[model samples]
Target: MPRSPWWGRKVARLPERGTLIVSTDLQGNYEDYYALKQIYADEEERGNEPVLLLCGDLVHGPGEYFADPARWPDYLGTFYRDRSVDLVLDYAEWIDHAKTVALLGNHEHAHIGGPIVSKFHGDEAAVLDIRLGDDAPRVHDLFRSFPLIAVAPCGAVFTHGAPRATEPDLASFERIRYDGYARTAINDMYEEGTLGALLWARYAEPEHAQALLEAVHEGEGRHAFVAFGHDVVRSGYEKIGKEQICVSTSFGCEDRNKTYLRLDLGARYTSVDDLREGEEIRKLYPKA
Candidate 1:
């Protein structure tokens, strides 16, 4: 068995008794933001402090609605002028209270890809430059600073996507570290077709999930779980192998329903909840 990549990392430990809000593929939906805010409020009222783990794709890509040439300018301007500002403000508030960690999704990389930002600058200054202007550097730094992989105190691994092609054995996994910008970092897990499979793959094979579980268990010296959110699971959550779970938290044209996972680290339990506007949050856990 190989050693776990998280070995000897001081920040990898998730605090016992703390709650974790595992969310993914927000795609710049303010409704989802409001739902998260409400969830936080509810937890506070219950005297619990929780950490938010954003699995990635905080921003929606141009492909989402830009396929129409006629609506390109309108959509692009809205994202840069309106959505960008709102995203920053909302994220700021999130970071103000609970500890927040984010992973890079393909959408974030699209920002660096220059197409969206190219609409404004026409040059190569980047989208953050056009959208954020003087504040572009700070925003760029923020995105670039996101870690690719984060380990919870309970040893559960959280990522925007799952590792498939480069799925490391225990030894390789142990050597893994958080490098926001390095090629070897988890960020690159979805770069090439082979590696990017982690970020872009839609389904998880039972064998791969089981391999991950075994690696985490052997390397971390504890029973561990893995969670990812790139692929939208219409069912909300899917159990893979013995202890791996995959969830989709995005709400939009594809998935009209808003959902998120509330993980109770202390109880070693997780529940899926539905968030609907003007309605009470419905817990869809224990599978009816």
Candidate 2:
């Protein structure tokens, strides 16, 4: 059977007008977390408000180490719990998970604490922070099940990582659902040893990135814009083609600098920018 179109697919329903702030490849740097919070605050100060879209890697080091929550609950829970509390509900209005959206990166997928070699295996993956004899799901579960395709009413598709060129499809957001796993395997297949492992770490190159965009644009909605994080580009946002956009906010782990995206549906799906180097996002969308 033919798959449903990406545009107007409605994988998940969301508000028409809201800001999307996304970051990826964060190996759990404390400083980046602080900066991300500030970005959230700035967006709230701005009239459009915002949804924090984190592509993955919330904690530091390899993901295999995180499979056991009892082992690193402090590392994972501290960050996750703080965010849920630190923000005063009265400040920026939001619905359910509307305030935050997250997806698992290679690190989170690796189980965060397993044997070093297992890090490259997908099926070996496990959720984080749930094994402490707890009754509820933990942070890892949230990222694992994140919708592969996030379609904004404005017609934008957001994914954690970009797809590879062999994909060769455009104009469909649904492709992201299956392609995401392939992208993860490719990350694990960089080479025979450690060097290849390191090379596969970042998300870049044009071919794969473009294929994913084309798939999403198939939706044929208002704007077929594709937003994503992963693969730190010194240049930041990249226009792979007329209908695709890639943005990275993890300006490296040590650098205090951070970048996030913002979108306004009412504006004909035309405006998109990176907020970094301490610039206030409120300038474009004033706080209501």
Candidate 3:
């Protein structure tokens, strides 16, 4: 039986209209996760078509917990609870809905057959696997089903990390393969191949990102810009070079600096310049 294209496919092409909301590494902040969800739900209620994209890494929160949530000694003093387990459940549920799509982050890849990730626990994947228990396989399946990249008609390329790739073209990404994993798993995520660049590279040069976006939109012969999350951006969102934007929604930054991206998909954008903080690049918790 052929695998469903919507599940575990290397790339996803989004529609030309509606609203697209993008979130970066959730790494365990359940509060921020729901905050973003509210925005999505509100958009739908307001009669706007909404599309939600989760850019992976919704794992590895604080290892030790104190009675007080904010007492975890976090920067900017946040109530950082690792409700990753709960978020994982919600994440899968959202993807089950036709309007949501998830892109695999390096942390997610760690569990099934990608590089091992460690933030709080020594081996986050191993520890998380134990925590997941019988549900681990199901959770892994959810991760495996995530697309590596999502392209929208508005010329935005949404991915987990930097756009640099060892491969010459996007087709190489589709050719990635894995052995002894879910038939639904996206291929070669564990290797230092194209998938590695997409899942792990930070501080990637602007030209590098632009080139990859070009290839991504090459079929449509459209100019494209890159929007991704992997590294922390203190200001919540960063305009990288002329063609890329980086957002930090739920991890690696102060509570106020955490951010997401929201845009009218019907409008076409040519560069990161078109996005403004508090507008397209939104703060999950705004500072009053």
Candidate 4:
């Protein structure tokens, strides 16, 4: 098995590899949450292993709250908060699972992926302190703490939304600041008073993805595979050339009755879909 290319240093000891259960867009979908728990429990009973990775919108939906951060909690309400915390905490508690990582989606930004202003009712800092607390791998600080989770050796980049491809890989994956093309999106869509707020809106149209892939391939070194959620991809995965791959598992539970990607580190070095379709994981979550 190859090590994560993003690390590029000494290969960390690979654990006894197992099946990974990738999911996202619950957005307070408690039933789906419980179903996943049941699935994981069954996997454990059968002695099969499972891990989880989330793309975004884990808590509130896009329309659940206003863009203003100050009114975040008022919009989130107590019910939403409890559900979000519960689902996240459940994954952390899963002992037999390999590991878990989730990215902050556009819905998380109270201001809807705008500039880093004091938008949320408790502010980003206060929310992190209060909501996350002792969990070193917390969910609130998606960009700052766990921006990009790399699992496959072919340099897969796991992010919440479609990153501006032209941005430097290290910079895009390493910091809280939304610079480069994403920044341009913020400026053109919001700061300059553009008609449409592009950042707030998820990337649905294919032209934007084309632009993103062009930007991504511009970088040097081994290209990083980008996996994200937001756009509703019924099939759960999309490929740009042989390098960039995007997955949308949210459709399954809500409308399409599907789940997210399950990657196998021991698989061939290619797109995220390839990893998910690897013999180990597919045997369980077969795509019909």
Clash count for each candidate, listed in order shown:
10, 29, 0, 8
TM-score of 3: 0.88
All models, RMSD in angstroms: 8.0, 9.4, 4.2, 8.7
lDDT of 4 by residue, 38-150 (tens): 66567657766654555555654322254345554432321222244565555445422434455455545432333332423424434533555675244443333323333
The model with the greatest lDDT is: 3
The count of backbone overlaps in candidate 3 is 0
Could you tell me every candidate's TM-score relative to the true structure? 0.65, 0.54, 0.88, 0.54
Against the reference, the lDDT scores of all candidates come to: 0.52, 0.43, 0.75, 0.43
Over 26-73, each residue of candidate 1 has an lDDT whose tens digit, in order, gives 666555556666776777678777666677777643442454655555
Query: Whole-model lDDT, candidate 2?
Result: 0.43
Encode model 2's per-residue lDDT on 1-288: one tens digit a residue. Answer: 111122123133345666666566555444455566666777778765676656554543335444455554432322222221122221122324236655445444444322222422333233233332242233334333444445565656565555432222332322333112333445354531321222233343544444444454453432355556556554445666544455555433223223455555444453233222233122211221
Q: Compared with the true structure, what per-residue lDDT tens digits does model 3 show for residues 74-131?
A: 5523557688788897776665554887888888877767755666776788988888
Clashes of 4: 8
Give the Å error, residue 286, model 4. Answer: 7.4
Q: Clashing residue pairs in candidate 4, if any?
A: 69-119, 69-120, 70-119, 165-215, 165-216, 166-215, 252-257, 252-258
Instruction: Estimate the TM-score for candidate 1.
Output: 0.65
Instruction: Please say which candidate is ahead in lDDT: 1 or 4.
Output: 1
Residue 209 shift from truth in candidate 4, angstroms: 8.4
Candidate 3 residues lying further than 4 Å off, grouped into runs, are: 1-5, 65-71, 74-77, 166-169, 178-191, 219-222
